[model samples]
Target: MVTHYGRAVLHATRHGFRVERPLQNPQALLRVAVGIVLGTVVGYVLDQQMLCVGAWLAGLGSMIPHQRHRLGVSAASAVLLCVVGPVVGVYVHDVTWLLYVLAFLGVFAGGMLMMFGIGLGMRAIIMTILMVALADLAPDVPTGLTVVKWLALGGALGWICQLLPPHGPRFATQRKAVAALYDALAADVRAAAEGGTAPQPWPGPLLAARQTLTVLPQFSRAAAASLFGLVGEAERIARNVRVLQTAEGAVPEIYRAQAAAVAGALSDVASAVRSGRPNAVTADWSSGALSRTRSGEAHENRVRDLVDALTEAGRLVDVPDAGKAADSWQHTELTLLHSQPGFVARGLRRLREELTWSSPVLQHALRLAVAATIAEAVGRATGDWGGLGEPGHAFWLFLTAAIVLFPTFEHTFSRGISRSTGAIVGGLIGWALTLLPDARALHYLVLIALLFLYLAFRSTGQPLMIMWITAWVSYLGAGGSSAWTRTADTVIGSAIAMALYLLWPTWQSKSLPRLLASWVRVEGQRLGALAAAWADPSTADPIALDRMGHEARAARHKFDEAATHAESEPVHHLARWTGPELRLLSRSVHEVAKCSAMLTAHLPGPRLPGVPDAARYAEPLHLVMSELATAAETGAQPDPGLTSGLRDIFGAELADTLPAWQPGPDVFGRVTHSVEELASAMHGQEAPEHRIRSARREAH
Candidate 1:
């Protein structure tokens, strides 16, 4: 009795149950839990129910990932909620039409704000909608001042909680992030020494470390500058290790032994940095052991460079004065950080870019706005037509639709399913709890426990988190019929979201090519920068190189994420590339990035003789990449001449003039081959293996 449709249904349903690994921050969970409990106690003492809810919402809103900016972010969120809540509440009270208009505008604005970041935008959306629902539910409109006061108190309490101990001192998050980078580098080095594949530098931890440092208070600039110096040292160490890893196979046994030693040293440095005990690092990399077996070969030189970089990193860790003898690298990083636009300016720029109708963010915002408006309208109509007990019954419907709708259809469908299931199950649990004797103390304890569990398990899965949230909300309200009403409303709201997505769906598959093209273009820019650096290191802007590398890495991440979402979509025909082809393109792009990084690691020191032919070859190659990107985006046949030109440039005998520190012909050959493979995958044909092999052989 098994059917194809049944299998498809089962496959899609499984996404609802997918559980990710739980978040590992016990301190953060504890902080959120304490904030919520304290807020509840304050509300009880003040005899103000709205104050309790405001605190709960504020606690959840302040749960941003950037711990260093927690207090500031919490304050900003509180101000936003307090200002927006009362204005919307006053305008929507007892006006059904105004409620719908405000819901649409509020939801749409919140969606647009997502470009700033999810931490702020999602909280704004939820709080704004919740206020709108509260306006509909209240018998009399509360004054704007009263609303502001309650929300401000809750916000203040939440912000104060962020100052709690156990989060470590200022720059703690930055330090931890930098420490993690060292740990990851050590792991990669160990793997490479054991004959594992050459590992790419993970940009995530490095980026996080840099971002945290950027946000440090001006008063902490000295310490932040020192940390920035350390971060640069870590990046250089990573690059040199990557180069060493690439050459490990051909290196002598002495070099491999040195690599093993370096890995151990790196691990110790990580531990030292994490523990703030630089003196504890006992690995003496400066020992004469390396001098005994030095061959002065290219591989030996690379190993030596790696050792030097590691020694510098250790020295940076031990430096006592944070701002003493700041290097050019630290100054450059700090200047860039200071030169960056403020949050408002950056957000406005992003909003302008996303205002286009073709933008996914804009489309999602429109969908959410319309969907929320419809949900509110239907809920209101049903309440009047079916004699639903209260206007607030519609709040669940509006809330579910707002939360469940995502940019992509697959996400919306999956989240809708999870929300519905969690609500139904949680409603049953709440009903069971209601049957017991009423005890305020017991209820408070249970609420606190549920809030903690919800916060702790938030990252585990949407279903589980939503289940706890539903139960907590249900228990917070009058029980029995209210629980059933909320559950039903959730199901209806989920259905409404699903229906709206089905009606006007944005398929990730259709966007895959565009994302892939953007990634390719960014990679090409990085390659061009690398070429320029190799052509003339003295004239090269290290900041520009660093920025391009970051851009390339970020673009690649976005493409990979889009490809994953596209894969889950049922409409495969909408995509220009097949799953296997997309994967091949991804691998090729990664190979290109890795080879560029390898070359970057071996870049000649400033004012050194540079590769003259690099700039010459890069110009045409850039054009070819641009054409390839265009072809990928437009679904048109690429110019065969472009590939031939690249092959010719890569195949030319330029190694004779290349600096010894620059990457060899083998690396260039790999990069060229990756480009060829990427083009082949996009064009739906096999790569020209004979031509590639000939080019690679000629280059060697």
Candidate 2:
């Protein structure tokens, strides 16, 4: 019932856990339980040397949904872990404890050396070694064959857990996350207009939001790995949609107005909540720019129109546009994110505290990059041998770590670090469990119970807790033995990863404000292109626009990376000044989309949407943007009248009224503010257009 953030706060307060995530639906949880039980029994039978694993772990072959079947992947890793685990375990088992320790060091060094290696090989190799050493600790000597059989069964069961169904309370969580951002931006525009009061804060929710970002990439990765095929479409849909920012061409003026309103409203909400004020600006239903006012009559038509354009822009994909009030209601995602700046915010907070690019999403990426390189190294060392007989199938783990992880490098670091931290804690717990005066079966149960506990409730970005729990289970099945070796291996692997990633580093990163400055440059260049285009609408300069798009993409990517690095590297992540800056970026780009639409739209021979030269408003808008960028970079308030003055001048001179055009929510609010803010930014600056006036003066 509680929103994700609320639950996070509750968990943090109650369990000393700040990061929290969704509760699996009863049905989904039940399915996992079923899989585990069946798997345990099957594994039991197989350990007794009974069954054939003519593996289908590749596709839906292992009972995981076809969507999730990495049959090709699992087949390879399972083969290695199963076949190689014992061979390596056998030879190493006979060594003295000192020799064993030496071997561990060799594996550790090998992991880093193979850092540039591919895939899940890293995990396969190291884990294989751990399994082998673990077998040696058993009272009875484990033939390589026994280790292989048990590992195969365990792996098959793990695969089955991943194939479970998605039966959660489907509140469209993913969709909500994205939509909230849209709504928040729209709200900001409206708030800026009408000389609105600042919004009140919402502390409770902010805590939850903070926890979400704190959870790392590993959890998401683990979920996808487990869920496989079913997860692919939904996740890809979100990702591709996000990348559509620069690709958007245009939209209707009314829709633009509405989006502007939402942007303003969201900004207000974010500011208010972060400041801890619950009495945020109340929504004014009548303030919108839709064709009609009533919900039933106008909401559907107007909302649908906006949704359609969003699709055209590649921002929104796969919406039915029924315009349910629930669908359009704001505060779902963006506010949640803004409210709990702690999780996502800490990175930015640190960045800003230290002049790094401090945006939430970007910070996460940086985290991922740092952590992944380490995890990759760890996985590689698991099965590797510097010069021993038959190294572990660690190459599989390496390939998996490299290939499956890190969409954005920064994010991977964030995720990998979170995983390592959690893994250490969980691994310790697993060790503690071994010390209990319990029988072999009891030890296995204790480990499983702890694994389930973590799976059910931990707030996480990294699911290393899950991995540790599994490793502990392996130890137990090996018969209350090998805890010391397993623990050592984990700690060593984590250390290797951290050491390599931290050592003399990529960015030597001193100043992140440069990123903000660079962001302005990128935004400026983009505006300049728009300016040239607006200067003459009839001129088809596709190349400039194309160039602008590429620049925007690169800037966006860099900003994200900068934010990530800023969050992770130094004591304080750099680039704090960048957060509020999103306003200008979002606003300018939205205008660019509008300008593109105005110039490109062919209307039976005319652009009669409003006044005569409304399309020509581009020149002034461009001027406003150039000045705004300068002011934003300098941190001083610009003349607050230029953009507004331009907007008004354009409206009065060019806008003829649209018949029956009821301005959507807060149009007056939006138009009034965007111009005001633009003007404020441009105030006192020598407008780029000033050259035109000067040239005329010389002629006079």
Candidate 3:
């Protein structure tokens, strides 16, 4: 019979074996391969194998996916490895006991630094641990210093290679991301015009574009601002298309041709943005379509406004002097200026906030620290027993534990399985390769080939990548005995990591309620902003609206990520909502976001009549959502009448002013229905409508 712990391990193991398709990036492959090759060649020429190893590891560390900061990360990684690794190596050679203490502190510090960001934190841990491992491998102080010189040489070469490829203009990645968003929007518009089922809300590209643009250097502020404006226009167009789709029969059959033309134009805009070319908006379909429709009709007005938006977007894309246009846009400049706090100050503030015991970063750091220390002690003890060949072999044990123990149970568990399996397989491969080559030239060729394959298939999944890494390291160390020893160390280290997680698991369920609550609060803010825009379009700040949209999208992404991880968990005692309840609530929140987007899409122009009581009606809805958020957070029941009161007020307010053809009443109704469902779910009951629908199905 399986024990409770056994069953939990089995469950997590199943999730661990899942694999993702590999991504192919030729530029990245070229950059990493060239750096490694150059480092290895220099090390061989100098007759220092460990120096080549340092170069290989440093090059690997610099292989971050973000092009914008890849150069900076590469340079930093080189410096950290060359300087810190040598210093640690030379000192630890004399004071053997000092190794364990530094191991614990380095791992803990690296984990804690993750509170700032993943990139910074991971680099710190990798550099620190690798340096200690390298120092352990050194036979003497003189050898250690020589290795440091090699490291510096290798690192410098890697940094210089990154500068070799000018991928394109400064904001190329940002442009590509924004262009992809437009492509998605165009596809959505075409689908909506065909009366197909409304596309599911996919905010990924939009969020990516926003994030990429936000990180651009201040020197390209003007160009970045233009890209930001394009991102905003893409969002607005998507929202309008969603609004048109939701209003059943809003786009009459006669106007479908015009809608198709508009979609084609959007495609052209995407192409223009991607290629950095001007797109002359030559389409007259909007004017011709307007001429055929009656003036002031709801559908006609929507088409006209959409056309005007398309025209403006085309003009923005074609602007010859983007900097001049960006200068004239005072609001975007002000937003950028306001956000320019010193980097050090911003980092410190974030660090302070994450220093608490409740922070996930701190919790993960503690777990990693404790685990690494334990691995180091156990490795040394095993070495004393002669179970491992040497004390230096403990580096494998320490390295495995450091990399495998991640923040969440799912990742840590999965990585442990992958790392173990790959290490075992890779060790066998390395041992087999040793049987074929007694010659030094043959050995170097095999090593270089293995390195190239490793970098190329790095994206395939951890198991494959780790296998290649293990093989290369085994080959570098030179012998079947060493390979076997490394494999054994890896398996033991993986077991330790798994045991630590089982004993002190950071279950995603524990954070689900907080994430869900945060999402609800963000949606409430987005609705309030939409209401304000509708009340007075002239006063609406596009930058503020864009910011709110970005926040809502980010919050939704967080909740979704937590929900996904929580599903694989063996226990849900800490979760406030059941799996089905979480799914229903997530869907309801998504609907609420879509409705808000639709309302924003139909916001009147400056000269048009405004919704007189838009804010007054929205106030109650916002308060109700806030209360629901609070209830989710506190695990308390919300007011039973909160959603009902929202519906009553919203319905009454929109009934007098909004036309029958308008989506305002429909959007409000959908929002209220979703809110009511959330309230019912919180109270541990099926929503009234959900129950009624179930009964109808049963009767049928």
Candidate 4:
């Protein structure tokens, strides 16, 4: 795949072409059909149109799996929507200015809240509008109550569907993500073992498997913990692979067999993850030179340990080790997330930080509110002018605007094209369905087909998704006539969304500098935390250090995203030019991360003379980071003087300390060298070919 930078790489796609998603969850279609059919039947038996809305809502629910932790939240959101929709529906008929005020307030508030978390963002926004619009159909208090009950019934049925399925979209993503990581790791190991060269840094597909844990509440605590353990193990294996590659020259010929065995095992694990089968391959630690070599004991041991880690990783993937891994991993999560003593205070502080004017969250929330308000005003104006007899004629327009106007320009603009085209296709299909004989039976059958197609293409193709959903909405709203209006509303809303984004775009080009600076600063802070921990193990909170490391990782991810976007921007000359430098900086951060991970796993390693005082290392690193951040902000090369000074300090320290250090890999020295290259790259200088090769070896 030719990937461009951003949330998703926008390949040069042919207009009007549809690409189906390689959807893994085959049962998803059946679940949706069952949920919708069961809900519709119940509504019909109850003799309530509101029940039909509930049934449709239930079908929507079946699309997402609700876990134990999220069940309450989902239920609450559902009930809130059901209750609020009917009240909004009745009042929308009122001519008073209060109605408009209420509409704006409700929508604006919801839009802002959606910006706060990924979980709530699009899902909450769409569902909230759906409930409100449906409630407006019959604006009486009794009708509202009926809608609520039916909606609740439908939601319950969807939750039930979740309970019935083990193989789900989220889990599949997690599996594929893990499998991809292993593939990268295995390939890197193979390349180094065969080529006798440093491997490239592993490109992307970086631990997104963790996303499944965050997004899917249906994942049990044990399952989440086990997956977390597997991910952690994968990280460790990658580090060890790098270590082996670094010591590749010292490896005796005998170690090749072991390396080969490890590679095969890694491939097996990847295959197992992809196929959801057992990982039967195991690493052969005994074959390594560690057992026979007397001179290169350190190198052999490093290779031996690499093989062992790989073996454990294979076991974890196949057997889970749920009892110990789950418990330990759970504790790690809690410690990382809730390390501060006062939870409420920390939460408040974080919220305040996020709500600041300069914060991305606040900026996005404000943008969304502005866009939604404009959409609503335009929709209302069109409805009044068009004088379409139907009371909610313009509601679809508001929905389209809200749905398509994502936070980023890239997302919003892409969605506009996809959604507009999808709406037309769905509209045509809906119209065609109405023309067929026995329209009622055909409508139900067509609805099922649309629902199935929507589930299949949900994550892959935007155009098809839009079409299926619009078609589904048309059948539910007015059987067939509503389809034409749906398409028109979508086109108008998409135009407005695109225009809004273009007018006040959040260009990645402009954000890259700040993002890069922030990333460096966070990494600096993480380094400081590690230094503090090393200085006083008694005072060190392992969990807190882990949290800092996680934060640094997240910051690096953001920087990469910014770089990707910057690379694709029309006039982002600096971003385009600095691509190689950005990549080196990324590798440098990874090096720091590896150091942190190494330190965490193997503490009490020989601390040479100069390495004893953590402050000595920490203070210089901090200075370099400050200089790098400054250079990033000013768009200047980092000063060569600062780079040389750090290099001299590291060289002098290593020369004085290495002889006294116990016989093992010089991890501290390794870290210092990486930082030097990192600083060099920050100054707009290319890293030395040797350093680049070594880091690249690790990366691959």
After superposition, candidate 1 runs with Cα above 4 Å error: 1-12, 20-23, 39-51, 78-87, 142-163, 172-180, 190-201, 207-223, 252-283, 287-294, 315-332, 384-390, 660-663, 686-700
For model 1, residues 1-700, the per-residue Cα lDDT tens digits are 2353244335656887898877557777677677778877877678554565666666666665443556666667666665566556766677877777778888898788775556656876776676766675656655645765776787667667767877554466677887887877777777776756435455656776766665565556666565677677777777877776666335457556767777787778777777676576655686654443445456566566667777777776666766654534454455566346655566678889999999989998999989887887777777733543334577678888998998865678788888889888888877777776677667666777777878877888778888888887777775676677778888999999988987888887898779878878888887877777778878888888877777777777777668777766666666787877777676676667787787787777786788878888777667777888899889898876567666656656555666675546766666677788778777766577735665896796
Candidate 2 residues lying further than 4 Å off, grouped into runs, are: 1-17, 22-33, 48-150, 153-289, 293-432, 435-444, 457-481, 488-496, 499-502, 507-518, 532-554, 564-606, 609-700
Error of 4 at 293 (Å): 7.4
Candidate 3 residue runs with Cα over 4 Å from true position: 1-15, 19-23, 67-69, 92-105, 112-117, 176-180, 183-201, 251-322, 330-342, 384-390, 532-546, 659-661, 684-686, 690-700
Q: How many steric overlaps are in each model, in order?
A: 0, 126, 0, 15
Cα lDDT tens digits, model 3, 258-347, are 567667878887877776765545565456543454444465566665676676677666677777777665444236432455446666
Backbone clash tally (model 4): 15
lDDT of each: 0.72, 0.38, 0.72, 0.59
Query: Across residues 605-700, which tens digit of lDDT does each residue of candidate 4 receive?
Result: 333222345556667777677777777777787776665665555446534543221233355555566666766666656567446776997998
RMSD for each of the candidates: 4.3, 15.0, 4.0, 5.9
Q: How does model 1 score by TM-score?
A: 0.87
Residue pairs in candidate 3 whose N, alpha carbon or C atoms collide under 3 angstroms: none
Cα deviation at 5, candidate 4, in Å, is 16
Candidate 2 local lDDT, 1-700, one digit each (tens) = 2353244224322332235564434444444445455555564444432112212111112222111123343454555544454445555555545333434443433233222222322543344444434443333454555645655665565455544555221122332332343333343334433324224212112222222222323224222121111122122222222222212222335445654544444444334323322344455533355332233332233344333333222212222331332234232221222223332345445434533444332332343333434443454455434443123333223322332233332433444445445555654565566567755455445544654554465334345444555354434534323333333444444444434444523431333334444544555455454434433445535545544543454444454455544433332333333333433433433343333322222111112223224345545555665665566566556664545565465345433332233232222223334445334322323333334545885796
